[model samples]
Target: MMQQSTIIIILLSLFFLTGCWDEQLLKDVALINSQAIDYDSENDTVKLTIALVSGNSNEKVPTNTTIVSAEGKSIRDGRTELDKKVGSELFASKNQVTMFSRKLAEKDIYAALDGNYRSPLSALTARLAVIEGEAEPILHAETENKPLISDYLRDLLISAEDTGAIPSVNLQNTLTTLYDDGQDIVMPRLKTVEQKAGAKLIGTALFSDRRMTGELNSEESIILLLLANSKKGAHRMTRKVQTDEVDPLYDYVTVDVENMKRKLRVKKNELGNFEVQIDLVLKMNANEYPGDDLYKRHVIKRLNTQLSEELTKEANIVLTKIKEANCDYLAIGRQVNAFYYSDWQNIKWKDVYPTIEMKANVDVEIIYHGIIN
Candidate 1:
């Protein structure tokens, strides 16, 4: 009798575990791959768009792709409006990219992103980008060739980060930087171009106070990436140095940077003013060093001097650009907070950030010359 009771209890437990109460089959659900948010300034409404992947596990090729959009006074409201068309609850757990329209970014995106931040299903790791034009076009363009636009954007962002063109900023990091008192934020700026090849990532957006303050060109964006310590892969540095009597007047040297370390020091001057000093240690391998003489002290010194000068010049240009844009990408305010907490409290970071004197010293070490000496 006890054995029979045990078997019956086991059968009942198995029956209770057999059903997935809140789970839907793959066929019954639409997989959301990417999302776009746009602001209609004239209509004073927020537009939310989602891209749904149309493919089955057994199918070798995707049948089609679909983009659905809805507009309302807020992001949540816009999502509710989208329910009218989707007919099912939206799921963002698989979302890979989130594109914000320029208009929406220009007006403070905090209110628009409240829904994403509050939602339990939303992904904090989703890649964020600022769309140059309309967000819907990016979601809709080349849908036939690219089954899912979100996956494409994700790959593009990963490539961009590897190439050091833009710093990788996910939803969580962006929000943290924006909310932190000692730092500002930046996002990859993406634009679709009319080219025979196809669309591509163009630039990056600079943000100040949770708004789109300006944009950085490709080169400037790379420099910003380096300054922000976001560079992960190899970055090439080209410098022209005046040669001696044996070589040409100028020889171009291409350096493959392997590693870079940056240290920031903030201190108060005797006059009570603040000064910031940046020290960078870089390790590099020479890709193209045309000089016949190798391991010469003068040659190394000359190369070091030229590299230092060029790097300082580039760093100053980037700093000036960010200052003009009114975006503090370097997080100079963090230094202030670390060294002079009391003074930072008395002074407004934005007001005094532009006036702070900065000095940069870069030291580059040539570790190798490829396979050669």
Candidate 2:
């Protein structure tokens, strides 16, 4: 009994004393906050740029920064070359953003991204975006009065989320959607604009089969938000309506819109065609209603009908644009897969998708008169 107790005590002490075998200290590791990748098709080489964070506390003292660029035939080889250029081990655990040139995304971003996903040090939650021009120029742009470039990129994504124009796609989400059969992927397309001091969020990149097939402009992106039911917070919608007792010109009402919700449904017809039904419910506050004492119930009814018609027209226009782009921003296939699994499997979605019919029914309900009837 004494011998066994002594042995058990010795094992516990050994276990407690044994620290992490492969511990990496913060001082020893160079933290990468952002990475940009550019592919040169002409030379069949890839260039990678890593942005390292300089933990300098003194505001007056200028901070020292370094950019390491490497080229190789493959992404892994390029990364190895970058490691050699940096002299220190390239740690990506602190990486917050990954950017790819449009040319690279147009070719295929899977292999380049695969290496990041496979590495244990790389963060799966890093935000992903596509640079409009060369990756290196955007990566090494001069930072004048802003925070770190990585933090700025992160803020750009968060601001886009607030606008409801583009949905955030992190590294993990991008890969999962790229691999999923029922759905496709999309990423925010960023470009350095002359308007907002330096950079701006232009639009979004539409992906099909892990390759960028098309792009959605700001208006088209808003339409995508409405169709996907991803819009949140306040959105501005304007419509012109004529009053019931209208004499033509002087009876127009221009309203500022708020509180919008959209519900979508997918169903298969008897003729083996997919039909999408969209029900849009929205409320409007009266901003500019012409004429004195125009609170008649029938006037409100007529205005609602007119608003509904206009909303339907706008919705169809946006849907048509998405269809033309060959991008399923609404995830119609996902709905079909969830509801009609057998039909989805038997049908070639790519072929059937373009031919799918969409019917949008918009209902505008007036809940408030903005403290004035």
| Top TM-score prediction, candidate number | 1
Q: What TM-score does candidate 1 get on C-alpha atoms?
A: 0.85
Task: Please list the C-alpha lDDT of all candidates, in the order they appear.
Answer: 0.78, 0.76
lDDT string for model 2 (99-167, tens) is 999999999979789888888888888989888988776665555665577777777787777766678
Give the lDDT of residue 53 in candidate 1. 74
- Give the alpha carbon lDDT tens digit for every residue of 141-215 in model 1: 663454556767798898878867778888777777878777788888888766422347777888787888888
The 10-residue segment of model 1 with minimum total lDDT is 193-202
Angstrom error of the Cα, residue 322, model 1: value is 2.2
TM-score for each candidate, following the candidate numbering = 0.85, 0.81
> What is residue 304's positional error in candidate 2, in angstroms?
5.8
